[model samples]
Target: MRDCCLLFQGGTQLPSSCLRDEDVVALFEGRLPVSVNVLAHHHAARCAACRTLLVTLAHGDALPSDSVPLALLPLEQGRRCSRRPSVPDATWTPPAVLDGFRLERLLGRGGMGAVYLAQDARGDRRVALKVCVALQPDERALASFATEARAIARIQHPNVVTMERVGEVDGRPYLVYEYVDGKSLAELRPPLPWPRVLDIAVGLAAGLRAAHQCGVLHRDLKPGNAILEPDGTVKLIDFGLATFVGSGGTAPRGVREVVGTPRYMAPEIRMGESATARSDLYALGLLVFELCTGRLPPVRRGACAAFKPEAGRGPAALLTEWLPGIDPGFAAVIACCLAEDPSERFAQADVLCAVLEHVRRLVAFQRTSRVFPTPWMGAGFPPPKDEGILAGHNVF
Candidate 1:
């Protein structure tokens, strides 16, 4: 091992430990740790994957014009790497079938894999199948799929997407989940009516409760991960980033990585702390705020740490400020979820679920009695300069 004290050594030797995907990302974003910054550059110079990764990341950044998509380049290497630019290839078609499921079409894709809507002929049902199609799947990517399969396999809930099967297709791990026949919460145009928002929030809480009861904590709980059926049934999907609840639980895939979606991550998680059920609730609070206002909470440096919620100064007050004439009781519910302090947030998912249900009933009753507090409040939050932040997706 090299000496940690070599503050500015012009090191030429490669570190025995290879740089991870996160390390590469941090290095590109200028967030890499100083101790290994030199080693990362040296390793990237020698490693084909890392060099290609830098190019891809650069293409995604300011130097995008420099990128020559794999499709445009050539088919010399058929491997799909996350670092590659995503260029539309009209010629590319879905494989007819994989294992037994008939691939209908591509639903979505990520750095490591693609999810397809498929037909489960034997079961006479439809399923969403996630297949790891990475050209040369890395250990972390494979471990993610395996961990997701195991995590979802252990929990069964109406609100949470149900897993049908787990197996490998051509050496790549694939997971089959019961299809929701609908779009994600994100797909449903934001600033949905307040009542509808409450319904989705309640369903999400129930799904989270189920996961928590099974000792699973969804480290990432953004709207995109929550699918809504035609009838508005919220089905929480994507357990790839989930972990067993509690401090003593084993790390995900036995690898501890703080690679959560920054916008949805709780303050503690952002500062490199273990995730908890409360952290998931914090994300829920952000989702609810977006649903109500069609925008996310501002992304300020050390936001949560700075905003210590006092009695009247909690998240509710801000919600009321942004959305005039909103129900105070309902605003308070979301405020509790957004509390900067974990201890101040809901102690359990079940508790939050019950509180939301109560609010829903009260709103319905008030509406029937013609005493509703607000007229389906969704009037505030002007469009942000960057539309990406429109749907409450302010990344830190």
Candidate 2:
């Protein structure tokens, strides 16, 4: 694939930022020099085009939306200005076969495109293929498509869905992913057993932490993005709205319009600010709250909808009113995640994972021994102040 960065330089297809198919093939085969291999991986970590090429060459598959209100359009829309076709989701017919993969059935579609369960005859595996069938290919749609493909490529964790290849059919952009066999958390009725909830919380936190460590921020984290496997694993998916943070850099300072689901949005995000790690956590907090209880967290309905963080109710109070029999400590951790102020939330996903791990240990211990333990029992009392969860104890 040609480098997008070079297109603006007199429309020349130069190898400025993107990797060539040959180099990617060598890199995938471990035939590149050590220095070049390191550099290629680093570039792939941040360059969507190169990453797409790398994944395509690695899996050996082939080659590689904007609209209403901008924000309400879909998380995949990039900030670039481009003319996009308005192909309604209901109007398109699924191609019988795309890039050697047979379309088995329609999974779902949104404002930007549709996803299908496809059969990869060569690989002998079922793959989830996402195509811009509804939007008709355009710059915005292409950018969003590559954005998700590149984002998932940077992250290598079992909890995150794996990207197999990137190719285009009939001038439309499409991505192939490992088809997950379980349902998303959004499909399950809530009020799950506390133990199960805690397990899901740990896995979800670990997954987010992996993404954060890779410098990829999932701006649109919600229950639907998390799929629960039969063995109780939560795999995080959908990075179309994800943002990559460069060294010593942050996400775009602001956005032209709000993105992500309004109910799952953080206050800052609703106000048109760039999403941060803390903001992602805020969305995660909402997700966990809904998982623990059967309903969503409290939100004010008005000109601007936002969470009631300062509302006169603590985590314990929430447990009493919304979810009884749940450990207040766990609730406190979720509250800390949903802090109204960005500075007040967990510093990063790993810190959140550390705390959740500790809570799981505490819960397991308490289940066997009914005896009231030490001061750690009240570690989550009141509310956590910043990294206060680790201030008094050695959580390492």
Candidate 3:
């Protein structure tokens, strides 16, 4: 067998012993770093068997793993391990096996990972690939990746950003998802139109319903992860902090502790308790609050907005003003979704769906009533004033 030439940029080399047969096995099974092009080059030059393994890793055509998301992994090893890899060179080119996936550019990164815009060469489709940081090869990061993949994989909804595949090349985990060519709600300038925002919320609620049906919980739901596609689709992405319930087992050992984004996290998660369906609902409600009022939910010491009709009313009154055309029952439903207590929120997605349908009807009713001029008209033709759902149609 030819000796493998392990290429280490900046003179960093993995001891030959570190690249053991067991490590290779783990690599083939989606448990190794998938982003180390240099390592792949080295392994290919030395071992024909490992070269073949490189092809497999590059193609990423393997079956999906039964493993849970990496968030659920044991973080102790990650915290204690000192095996961080050097960051890739800016001009590095990945091996040929990754040929089909054209990595066009880099996207913004988060605490756990970075995102890239890539294309599916096979289908001429675009995708967003999220690669976790390889620093230290922490077990906790691995578990988070695995957990996200497993939870999102179970959900199939048009409004949800779907997880297409999961791959691990060297020692790092990567997630492949359908590329969304729209800005996140948080990134939109001047905010979104009221109708558009409501549409997004409806679409998001629909996806959440599907997730709940599949026994999955989106522990962290926020505008930052809500994608608005060019074609007007609202997609909920980033399940990194989500949890899978009734998975026919207990919560993964590492994930049992509190995990989720702070701003959108439910009180229970903040309290270090296990997340439930209602927890997800609470997050969604918080998201709705942000979308409707251009602000966050009432935090400590903040006065709750009054339900008054004014140009710059707080979220409560704003919703009351624009939502008058909606049935009172549906308004109550939205209120219930925003309940302070998780238990008081809508427990099931179906209930929210019913409320949304009613709101849609009200929107239509209000529109028709304006166009046809009613018999109850009082005097001379009055100047047309913005009313109903259309009142806030020009959202940024």
Candidate 4:
């Protein structure tokens, strides 16, 4: 791979120079060093050969144009240049084989890449294959993809999605994840039962705790990123926006340039601050709110301003109004998770998990008591000989 940076003399026309095949492969496979990434971007802008190579690597076809979005361009001196390059008009076509995995069908596509439901020939198991789209092949996007693989690999928990392998085929980087046989929480219609919601919340929190223990911060946590298995197990998925705590810097900030979903983003994140474990907790709080009320917390967007909190009422009040029988403790936990100040929220995912577990038990006890009330013990009944139902139970 080329190690030298390409110097540009400022012109809109294509440059006379082109990238080497090795350098193009390295860039698409996310193997390029930071320095080469900047040079690759500059050269890709003017060299149709490099652009077509990237297109072929991403989609197995040539593109009509090679206009790169300004957002995808690397920031120079922490600032984005004003020039807009033409983005290539390309479409993705799933390849039959990637490495040893046989692609069964395209699962979905996102801003970063496309996912395929694939079969691992060697292991004889199905997996979700995520291939990085190479339309622009920006360094940041490649870095994010690599970060997700590293993050998921570090976390091994039943509630978190498992990564089997990561490899590049035909210059396209891809990830193999344990295929989940269920729908995302986003697909579940709201007005979900409180018990069911709490069950999912507990699992999600546990997963987050596991990730946090590994120093991986899942900056993006939303219903769409959580899957509900057939056995009621909730698995957190999509760590593309995840970052390590103290990993040097946060995402670049600008108008509509945040990395996470606006509705679930913490206040600090909305304010362009680096996301910490607490930020994940805040998103969990929002997920809980959405599950209970069938809607996200209200926010308003100005013409040029970021999203601002617009809910006139506290979460507890809104929750109580929506579900009158909701547990006060549960409501309080949600409130704490949504605290504007990171310090005010739950210190860790485990803390939130413990509280949610307790609330679950309380709800279970209440339901059981209602169903099987201790028959009004008569004077002779002697309080039913202390049935031991509440025995060994820790009073919350």
Candidate 5:
């Protein structure tokens, strides 16, 4: 019982303990030779006096340096006589899916969930995380919410914000989404350029087309839900209120005011009629109007109002100059979308996408004679030297 410590002391001697020299080496190897590792096996085999000394060394009250040649181990083992890394306080253990994602800040909150900005582990990429709270809702509402999550998970398009993963922790749902880097169209204070407006319109049309192809409809199509990513990409989000075109609360089938915001709501949606694909188109047209003119289409007192020439002047004027020879076509398309009769609008999102592509070609044709300055260059931005917009501004 006295042999263990004596065997380890001064680099060699049998101690008044039961642990053999071979047992001591085995314990050291088990700990990977880390300093101050508690000799559990040796203690279990030792007498009371030897056990007490081992306990003191394990607790760090007594140094094992004089008894053992631990200094020959790694620098870290020699420096700290501790069992584990020094953790000052208990920290919140993040969910497994969010292991290395550093939560930056809460972006916004809605009825279904909250959005947060976080850094992805791999490349430190910025991403948006939508975490759903298990709030007290009726069974029907909860089912609908889950359905929305599943529907969005099935969609894939460059213009639609991609759902990375869906995680459930403690009965709460969390959605990981690709981060869109630009401000919302509604948040764009001034009127946007015709080209930029068309760009967003084309992207939105493409995204909606994909959703429609899969038998889905974005009941709520508003500027607020569209974002321009930093890479000049557009993405549409907030599908929590969306539903299958003919299923759930989608118009022509259900009675609830299921999707869409008031300002951009189609006449059908507002009238308690079934929201159709055309209803989504109508909302998209309204968003286009907002982007081009920075004005909301006026709705009368408790009813859809007539397009008053005076009130619609801002957007109308911009459209006039921007459209030129192509203005009538654009106006006609928008008017058709906003028609009181859903049947009068474009039958499918693909048709709308084609129409928008044509508009882009028209813009390119119209700008052939004169060069329009880059939109970002208007506010004292450096112009392309090769493009000859500046003098001696060598950007290369």
Candidate 6:
């Protein structure tokens, strides 16, 4: 212990009595005395082992080459002592006015940006102001941001949030969208009534259909991206990951990386394949399943055939077991949307919407007839038949 202390004190009597690990750590952390620091530096310059130890202690790993001098390396004291500009807290005062809009309170925030509830002075309407605050925007992120604006601008639907305009404030790209005075579906307490869930599902599908008609694909669709109005109207929001397809527009530029909420992503998307309209339908199916059962279905592995039952039952049987009380017709629609093979799923969003609308009408009719028997059915009316609900329609 005495020898170790002496070595840390920079005694030059015994050059081989090198500094201890504690001393090395202290020196790296700038905790060593000034005199000892100078002596330690001089000793480290001459000793190969001491130099390697100092480099390791400072950087947590050995450098590739020892040819670099110790003085040139970044030290703890140098980094701490250097003055750096303070980053302003944007939420503190926020801006009084940005691009002619009066900034109000923050709505939400994500990895790439923050959304604020703002009032458009010119239009006298409230709008959601989304600003990209990334210090350095990568090619993919920039392309996606621009793509979102273009995607929303091309589609006009009651069930989809509308973008008013886009502009830059202080070099940050910001988008203004029609503000939705409602909560996200994710905020809803679980076990929402099936009727209300069906309503939301119908609206979401309609919005997706509209987007699809415009040759747009919402790559990321989930409960969190859906806003539910007081009147049970669901409006789909956030097209940051949307891409265009077919003749209406070009595919998302520079979007090579897989982009979507993983849990809601389709099997093909999870496997790094390009997202199609069917992929969006798959995500919508997951969203509907969550709204119905307040939970996600069991993960499907490998191929769709794996989910097939030994008795030759369809995949819908699997979901029926997990979500009791769910209408068999509705469950079957969801299962078809979640088909591992895109070809097995609804070919278009409009077709899925039509099927869902029919199911909703049947469910409503059954509920009404069960409570109050119609005159045509005497005292009791049998529940509506599901035989013709999907008949004569090319769903697959």
Ranking by lDDT: 2, 1, 4, 6, 3, 5
lDDT of 6 by residue, 17-76 (tens): 344333444466465678767777775554444555465445422111111211222234
Q: Over the stretch 103-163, how does candidate 3's per-residue lDDT look in tens digits? A: 7787756545668898888887888888776555566668778888998888889988888
Per-residue lDDT tens digits for candidate 5, residues 1-396, read: 112322233333333333432233234224223322333443333333334434433432211112322222222312222121112122223343464567788786543456788888878688888765434333533554576677688788898888877766555656788887787665677467656777888888898888877667777677667887665677888776666754332444543342445456566554456667778887888788767666654433323332333433423343565555324445544554554556656767787787667656655665785654432233232321221122222211
What TM-score does prediction 6 earn? Answer: 0.68
Q: Rate the local accuracy (lDDT) of all candidates.
A: 0.66, 0.67, 0.56, 0.65, 0.55, 0.65
User: What's the CA RMSD of model 1 in angstroms?
Assistant: 10.3
Flag regions of model 2 displaced more than 4 Å.
1-87, 300-304, 309-312, 374-396
Model 4 per-residue lDDT tens digits across residues 277-346: 7788888988888898797544433211212323435566567777886665566667667766567667
For model 5, give the 10-residue run with minimal summed lDDT. Answer: 387-396
Winning candidate number (TM-score): 2
Q: Which is superior by TM-score, 1 or 4?
A: 1
The 10-residue segment of model 4 with minimum total lDDT is 381-390
Where model 1 places Cα greater than 4 Å from the true spot, the runs are 1-94, 246-256, 303-313, 371-396
Residue pairs in steric clash, candidate 2? 65-140, 65-141
All candidates: TM-score:
0.70, 0.73, 0.62, 0.68, 0.61, 0.68
lDDT of 3 at 294: 64
Q: Distance from true position, residue 18, model 1, in Å?
A: 22
The alpha-carbon RMSD values of the candidates against the true structure, listed in the order shown, are 10.3, 15.9, 15.8, 13.6, 27.0, 15.4
Give the number of colliding residue pairs in candidate 1. Answer: 3
TM-score of 4: 0.68
Give the per-residue lDDT digits (tens) of candidate 2, residues 1-396.
112222222333334334332344446556567765766666455444445545544543212112212221221335221112232434456579887999999886655668899999797789999988653455766787889989999999988999989988777788998999999888899888767888998998899989988989887787778899999989998888787886532476643445565557677765556677878888888888787887765554432345554444644357546777677567767777776667767777888887788888888888789854642565553344332222322231
lDDT of 1 at 231: 89
Query: Which stretch of 10 consecutive residues in model 1 shows the poorest summed lDDT?
Result: 387-396
